[model samples]
Target chain A: MLEIRNLTASVGGNQVLNGINLSIQAGTVHAIMGPNGSGKSTLSNVLAGHPQYIVDGGEVLFDGVDLLAMPPEERARAGIFLCFQHPVEVPGVRMDHFMRAGYNAIHKSHDEEELDPIQFDRILKDKAKIVEIDPLLLKRNVNEGFSGGEKKRNEILQMAMLEPKLSILDEPDSGLDVDSLRIVAEGINQLRSPDKAVLLITHYQRILNYVVPDVVNVLINGRIVRSGGKELAAEIEANGYEGQGEALQPSA
Target chain B: MTTPDSLAQSEYKYGFVTDIEEETAPRGLTEDTIRWISAKKNEPEFMLEWRLRAFKHFMTLVENHQEPKWANVHYPPIDFENGVYYAAPKTNPASLEDVDAEILSTYEKLGIPLEEQKRLAGVAVDAVFDSVSVATTFKETLGKQGIIFGSFADAVQEHPDLVKKYLGSVVPYTDNFYAALNAAVFSDGSFCYIPKGVRCPLELSTYFRINAAESGQFERTLLIADEGSYVSYLEGCSAPMRDTNQLHAAVVELVAMENAEIKYSTIQNWYPGDENGVGGIFNFVTKRAKAAGNNSKISWTQVETGSAITWKYPSVLLQGDNSIGEFYSVALTRGYQQADTGTKMTHIGANSRSKIISKGISAGHGSNTYRGLVKIMPKAANARNFTQCDSLLIGDQCGAHTVPYVEVQNSSAHLEHEAFTSKVSEEQLFYCRQRGMSSEDANSLIINGFCKEVFQQLPFEFAVEATRLLEVSLEGSVG
Candidate 1:
C-alpha cells in the first residue's frame, strides 16, 4: 500500500532522512523505533509532505502513484494520513466544522456527494465514540483547551472520519496516560482492515503491548539500520542499539 | 470563498459608476459652501443656523488641529478645497415609477431592488444615492403601525419637530473634528421613529451609494425609540471605484427612551483602494447611542470591511440608571487598507452596564488597530463593563495593534478587559488544507470563526451579506 525508495530529506539546511527504504503491504501493521535524533519523526514528516522538509533524493509511491509529486493537500486527498505528535490548537475553529470540512473535501476529490452538516454530524458522533471523545469537545474550538489525551483522541477521531487507506501514527502514545494508551490502541485496532495499512512510530514498548506490530525497524543516523520481525523491539529493549547501529560500526 | 466565485476574485464587484447629470456644489469649504448645501436641501431657518454654528467650529478645528495625528493610519493630506461637499442626481421622481432606470439598476446591482423591496418581509429600505435619498420602500405598511421610516430630508421637511428634537441629541455637533464637518454639510440619510409603546413591525434599513466623482458624502442618521417602544435599524453603504480619494464623514445618533430598546447594525463596503492603495474612501464617522431613561437599552453592531482608511468608534452612553449598552464590531483591512476602529462605553448612572467585543483582521500590507475606552463616572456606583478585543494577522506583511483605556472614578465600579493577538501560521493553514479545503476556504473559515461573536448580532440577511463581504474583501489576502 505504501513504498519509499532511497528517500533523502533536509530541514533548515540540516539532513534528517538519508538513503531510507521501506514498504508496507495491506492488512499489516509496521512499527519504526529508534533513539532520539534517529530520524524516526522525520520519516513521517517526509511522508506527510511538510513543506519545510526539502526532498533531496529518491521517490515515494502510494497506491502506485507518485506521492512525492503531490502537494500536501493532494497527498491527503489520496488517502494518506499523518497524526501529528502534537496537534495544533486552532482557537476559533469548531471541531465539528473542522471534521466536516475534512470529510467533505476528501469526498469531493473522489467526485462523491458531500454530506450536509446534519448528516455529517451523525458520522462524526459515531467516530468520536470510536475514540471515546467527549461529545462536548465537538462544539468547542479545535483542540483549543483540550487535554493531552483528548488531542490524541481527536487525531484518531479525524482519522476515523477521513478513513484514509494508509494511517501513520507519529508518536501517538507520547502524551497518553495508561488508560488513554489502552483506549487509543483499541481505537487503532478497530480500524484494522484487509485493505488498510498502519505504520506506528513510537519510542517505548508500552503501546506495542496493546497494538502489536508485525514488523519493527530500527532507525539511526538518518537511515534504517536494521529490519526484522516484532521480536526486534524486544531485543532492542533488552540490549539498547549501542553497538548494533552504524553509529558503533568501525570507520570504513 | 466556498467555491472561489468570480465575484470574490474580482478586484471590486461594486465599482461601476452610473452616468447621469448631477448638480454639484462648489468644490470648496467656505461659509457659503455650508449655506449652499443647507439652502439646496431647503432646510428650515433653525437648521441653517445649526450648520453655520458647526461650520464656524469646524474652521476653528481646521486651523488648530493636525488632521487627527493620533490614529494608526497614514494618508496624504486631504485637499478640502478639491472635493464638492454635495452632489445629487438631477432627477426628482414623484414616485418610484418615474425614477430613472439607471438609478434603479444601480440599486439592483447592489442587490437591493426597490420594487422587490416590498416583497421582502419585515424589511423597509431607504436608498440614498450620492447626497439625496432616491426612493424609500414599504412606508405605507410601516406608517400604519405609527412608525415613521423615510429620508432624513423628508423628515426635516414634514416631521420637523421630531427631527429637530433628536438630530444632535446624542452626538452633538461639537463632538469631534469629523463630527463638526459632517454637521456642517451633511446630506440625506435614513430617519426612523417608533412611537410610544409601539414595537416596529419591520426593520428600517438604508443603503448609501456614492457615485459622483470628486464628491464628499456627509450623511446624517437619527433614530429615536420613544417610551416602551422597540426598533432595529440596518445600514449598508458602498461606493464606485474612483482614482482620486473621496471623503466620507458621517454622523449617526440613536436615542432609546424609558423602557425602549434600539438595535443598530451596519455592514459598510465603501470603496477600498486597489492592491497598492491608489485611491479609496477615508471613512471618518461618529456613531453614538444614548440610553436616556431607566431600563432603556441600545446595541451597536458593525462589520467594517472596506475603505482605504477607517477612523471610527461607534460608542454608547449608559446615562440612565440600570440601562444597558453593547458594542460588537468586526473590522477587516486587506491590501493597503488601514483601519483604527473600536468602541467607547461610558457609564454615568448607578447600576449601568456595558459590553464591548471587537475583532480586527489584517492581511497583505494592511494595518488594523483596536482603540477602545471604558469610563465609569464618579457617581456611577456599582457600574460594570466588560471588553474583549482580538486581532488576527493573515500574513507577515500585515500589522495589528490593540490600545485600550479604562478609567474608573468609583471604587465599586467593575471593569474587565481581555485581549488576544495571533497570526495565521503555516501550520494552521496546512492543517486545514491537508483536510482538503482550498487555501481560500480555510482562511475564510478561520476568519468566520473568529468573527462569529459579532456576526451573531446582525440580522440573518445582513449576517450572510457580512460574511460574503468579508470573503470578497480578503480574496487576495491569502496566498
Candidate 2:
C-alpha cells in the first residue's frame, strides 16, 4: 500500500533522513524501532509532508499516487494518517468541532456527502467507545490540559474516524500507563483489516507483545539497520539496542 | 472563493452612493458652524452653550495638537474646514412615511430594514442618514413601556433632564481631540433610556451610514440605564466608497446606575480604502461607559473590520464599589486598512474588577494595533484586572502590534496580563491540512480558536455574524 525509495530529508539545513528505503503491503503490521534521535519521528513527518522538512532526495508512492508531490491535506484525503506523538493544544477549540470538520473535509475532498453535527456526533460517540475515550473529553478543548493517556487515546479516536489506508502511529505507546497501553493496543488491533496497513514507530518492545508485528526493523542514525520478524523486537528488548552490532552510530 | 488578485479588486459591498436631495452646512468649522448645527437641531440654551464650549476647546487643540501621532497609522492631514459639518436629506418630514423613497431604498440596499414590519425580530433600529435620524422603528411600543428610545435630537427636546444629566458624564467633550470634535458639531444619533428596574425587552440598535459626499458624520449617542435596569445596545456604521477620505468622529456615553447592567456592541464595517489606500473613512470614535453605582456592570464587545484609519478605544470607568467592567474586541484590518483600537479600564472604587480580551488579525498590508490601559487608583483597594491580547498576522507584509499600559497605585490591586504574538504557525496550518481541510479553512479554524474568548462575549446572532465577517476579511489573505 505504501512505497518509499531513497527517502532523504532535512530540517533547518540538517539532514535527518538519509536515503532510507522501505515498502509496506496491505494487511501487514511493520514496526520501526529506534533509539532517541534516530530520525524515527522525522520519517513520520516526511510522510505527512510537513513543511519544515525539505525533501532532499526521495520518492514516495501510496496506492499508485505520487505522494511526495501532494500537500499534507491531499495526502490525508488519499487515506494517509499520522497519529502525532504530541498533539498540539488548540485551546478554545472543542474536540467535537475539530473532528467533525476534519471528517467532513476528508469526505468533501472525495466528493462524498458530509455529515451534519448530529450525524457526526453519533458516529464520533461510537468511535469513542471503540477507543475508550470519555465523551466529556470531546466537549473540552482539543488536547488542552489533558492527561498523557487521554491524549494517546484521542489520537486513536482520530485514526478510527479517518479510516485511513495507511496509518503511522508515532510513539503512540509513550507516556502511557500499563492500563492505557492495553486500551491503546486493543484499539489498534480492532482497526486492522485486509485493505489497511499500520506502521508502528516505537522504541520499546512492550507494545509488540499486544499487537504482534509481521516485520520488525531497527532504525539508527536515519537508516534502517536490521530487518527481521516479531522475535527480532524481543531479541532487541532482551539484549537492548546494542545487543546486535552497534545499534547507534557516532555523530560525524 | 478569492484569489490574491481578485481580492485586491473585490468591490466594496455597500459602496453605492445614494442620490437624495440634501440640506448641507458650509464646509468649515467655526463658532458659526457649531451655532448653525445647534440651531438646526433646535437645541435648548444649555445644549447650545455646551457646543460653543466644546468648539472653543477644539479650536485650541487644533492649533497645537498633531493628531495624536502615537497611533500605529498614517493618513493624509484632514482639512477640518473642507468637510461639510452637517448634511441632511433635502425634504425633512414628520414621519417615516414622509421620508424620501431613495433614502429608504438606500437602507434596504445596505441590508438594514427600516420598515417596522420588516425589521429584524427583537431588534429596534434607529437609522441615521448622514447628519440626522430619518426613521426610528418601534418607538411607540418602547414608549408605552416608559422606555424612551428615539433620536438624540428628540431626547434633547423631550427628555431634557435625562439627556442633560447623562450627556458628557462618561465621555466629556474635553476627553480627547475626536471627542471634542464630536461634541461640537455632532448632528444627531440614537438616544435610549431604560427606566428603573425595567429590563429592556428589545435590542436597541443604531445603524449609521454616511451617504453625503464631502461631509463628516459626527453622531453622539447617550444611553442611560437607571438603577436595577438592564439594556443591550448595538451600533453599526458603513460609508460609500470614495477617493477623498470622509471623516466620522462619533461619541458614545453609557451610564449604568446601581445594580444596572449595560452591554454595548458594535460591528464597525466602514469603507476601508481600496487596495492602494486611496480613499475611505477615518473613523475616530470615543466610547465610554460609567458604572455609577455599586454592583453595576458594563461590557463592551466590538468587531471592527473596516475603515482606512480607525482610532477608537471603548473604555469603562468603574466608579462604584464592586462594579465590573469587561471589554471584548476583534479588530481585522485588510486591504490597506489600519486599526488602532482597544479599551481602558479605570478602577476607582473598592473591589472593582475588569477584563480585557482583544484579538487582532492583520492581512493584505493592513496594520493592526491593540493599545489598552488598565489603571487602579489608590482608593481602589482589591481591584482586579485581567487582560489578554493575541495578534495573528496573515501575510508577511501585514503588521500586528500590542501596546498595553498598566498602572497599579495600590499594592492590594491584582493585575494579570498575558500577551502573545504569532505568525499563524506553519505547523498549526499543516496539522489542520493533514486533517484534509483546505489551507484557508485551516487558517480560519486556528484563528477562530484563538478568538474564541472574545466571540463568546457577543450575543448569539452577532457571534455568528462576527465569525463570518472574520472569514470574509481573511479571504485570499494567506499566501
Q: For each candidate, give its TM-score against the true structure.
A: 0.95, 0.94
Docking class of 1: medium
| lDDT per model vs. reference | 0.87, 0.89
First chain TM-score, candidate 2: 0.96
**Tens digits of per-residue lDDT for model 1, B386-471:** 99999988767778999999998999998898999987777877778777777777788888889999999999989999999888
Please give the range of 10 consecutive residues that has the lowest summed lDDT in model 2 chain A: A243-252
Q: Residue A184, candidate 2: how far off, in angstroms?
A: 1.1
Q: Per-residue error at A23 for model 2, in Å?
A: 2.8
Q: Model 2: per-residue lDDT, tens digit, A1-252?
A: 899998999989999988788999999999999999889999999999888888999899999788999988899999999999988777678989998888999999889989999999998999999878889889998888989999999999999999999999999999999999999999999999999999999999999999999999898778888889999999989888764435434431
Cα deviation at A186, candidate 1, in Å, is 1.9
> Measured by C-alpha RMSD in angstroms, how accurate is candidate 1?
2.9
Q: Candidate 2 recovers what fraction of true contacts?
A: 0.70
**Tens digits of per-residue lDDT for model 2, B1-479:** 24334445346788899987899997788999998989988899999999999989898988996467888889878888666999998888799788788988999888787876788888888999999999998888888878999899999999899888888988889998989989999999999999999999899899999998889899999999999999989888889999989999999999999999999999988888888989999999999999999999999999998889999999999999999999999898888899999999999999999999999988778899999999999999999999999998876678899999988899999999998888777777777788888888987888899889888887787788778877876767764
